[model samples]
Target: MIITVPIELPQEIIEEIVQLTKQRIKEEQSHQTKVNEIPPYPTRKQLKQILKIGDSRLNNWIMNGLKTIPFGKETRFDREDVKQFLNDLKI
Candidate 1:
């Protein structure tokens, strides 16, 4: 046996859904802003000094994504992100 269901949503329901979607998007963007608040760039040496880790361990951490170290054509680290990562470690 087959059951029939309504094909179209009511206008009010659609509007509510749209509003909720927008609200959720706004919230997500704000959360991203907070996460992205990490600071200016720093070199690998500086980062290693700041975190007090050896080259191998630092490389491993970067590989594991414990910190937001960017790689590729440009090697850079956000200072604030490093600080935040360190701060997060205190917990």
Candidate 2:
């Protein structure tokens, strides 16, 4: 024996629900990918290397808008923030 349930929903509403679910699943997958891939704070030198910028340029970026987390003598930057900064610079 098989049981079936029938429900009626507007086509637009169904489409919207499907889209939202897809977006949510994508976000969950993206978060999982980054959850264990990055460190909380990356050192300034490491950031410079990641961005492939010289010291002077890095200083210029820091002055422009890049943010840093200071821990006594060590300065670190959030990897996500750095990526966002670079993304924001795209024309």
Candidate 3:
């Protein structure tokens, strides 16, 4: 056996809940858009251009443990791996 009851929430509370849900969905969509924009493997020139890092800085980062992936005739960087490597460097 089960019992059921119906309750009503204050209108302001309901509106707040709806607004928060919309905000959360908007944030998720924005994040997805940004994530989708990045290629899984970006070439050296593309990476440098996007990140605005010069050759010596890129070399220093690689020396400090940044990694590269070979893509056919050129070298590329894994987007996720690069993100993790840089995040790990944060103080």
Candidate 4:
């Protein structure tokens, strides 16, 4: 058995609770976004397989702060991004 009582709340108080809940949700979303925004860190062996390049060349690129876009469903790299990166390197 359970007892239930419906108590009326002041309109302002109800609105304030709703506002606070919305603020809490927004704060959580902001925190999650920051947490998920991590930079990529590719390994030497993996890089050799994916790029199908020589270790010497891959090592050269990796040492210079080269990284991929944040990985999603699959490991993907944009050719244009690579071009821009290489252009920046002047190599």
Candidate 5:
């Protein structure tokens, strides 16, 4: 003897799943924006002090794209950027 069962998902459940998917996508976008937001600037000395890393190391990070340090032609470090970098380092 073989038993066969028909399985069907309710329309309400499908709608709920679609709504949840959209909500999750929106939340992910918001999170990405927060991550992409640029931090403020810090001086070279201040950055070193805060991150406890040498100038070369920080420069390497910038070069490798692990972090972003925007600067004008004069090349200055943003304090808030360093703070954010430090925060990112936290496990």
Candidate 6:
């Protein structure tokens, strides 16, 4: 069930509310744009599962040339980077 309440406001107040709503929409769009710029970097555990590789194998790849972005104590790899790394490998 839905309920509706009737309220009255001055014309100026209504106009101000509409303008504020537009401003809020613009702010949300800007925030969304920034969020979209972030890369989908997978954690080490996730990468291991995705690639079906063990710890030693993953470490070996990292030692060779697999690029990793370290965030403090955690390591992450971009999806595209991992794809490129696999493509570069002849096997």
lDDT for 66 in candidate 6 is 90
User: What's the CA error at residue 31 for candidate 6, in Å?
Assistant: 35
Question: Candidate 2 residues 1-91, lDDT tens each?
Answer: 2322267877787777777778998986775465335466888777665455788987887898989888889988887777777667778
TM-score of each: 0.42, 0.54, 0.57, 0.37, 0.38, 0.54
lDDT, residue 49, candidate 3: 70
Index of the highest-lDDT prediction:
3
Q: In model 3, which range of ten residues has the least summed lDDT?
A: 1-10
lDDT of 6 at 36: 44
lDDT of 6 at 21: 78
What's the alpha carbon RMSD for model 1? 12.7
> Candidate 5: what lDDT?
0.59
Please give the lDDT score for candidate 2. 0.72
Query: What's the TM for model 5?
Result: 0.38
Candidate 6: C-alpha lDDT = 0.75
Q: After superposition, how far is residue 15 of candidate 6 from its true place, in Å?
A: 76
Q: How many backbone clashes does candidate 5 have?
A: 7
lDDT of 5 at 7: 57
Quote the lDDT for 62 in model 5.
Answer: 71
Cα RMSD to the true fold for all candidates: 12.7, 9.6, 8.4, 16.0, 12.2, 14.6
Question: What overall lDDT, based on C-alpha atoms, would model 3 receive against the true structure?
Answer: 0.76
Per-residue accuracy of model 5 over 3-85 as CA lDDT, tens digit each: 22355778777677777778998986775555444335555565555445797997886775454444665455654554455
TM-score leader: 3
Candidate lDDT (C-alpha), each = 0.64, 0.72, 0.76, 0.56, 0.59, 0.75
Alpha-carbon deviation at 43 in model 3, angstroms: 0.3
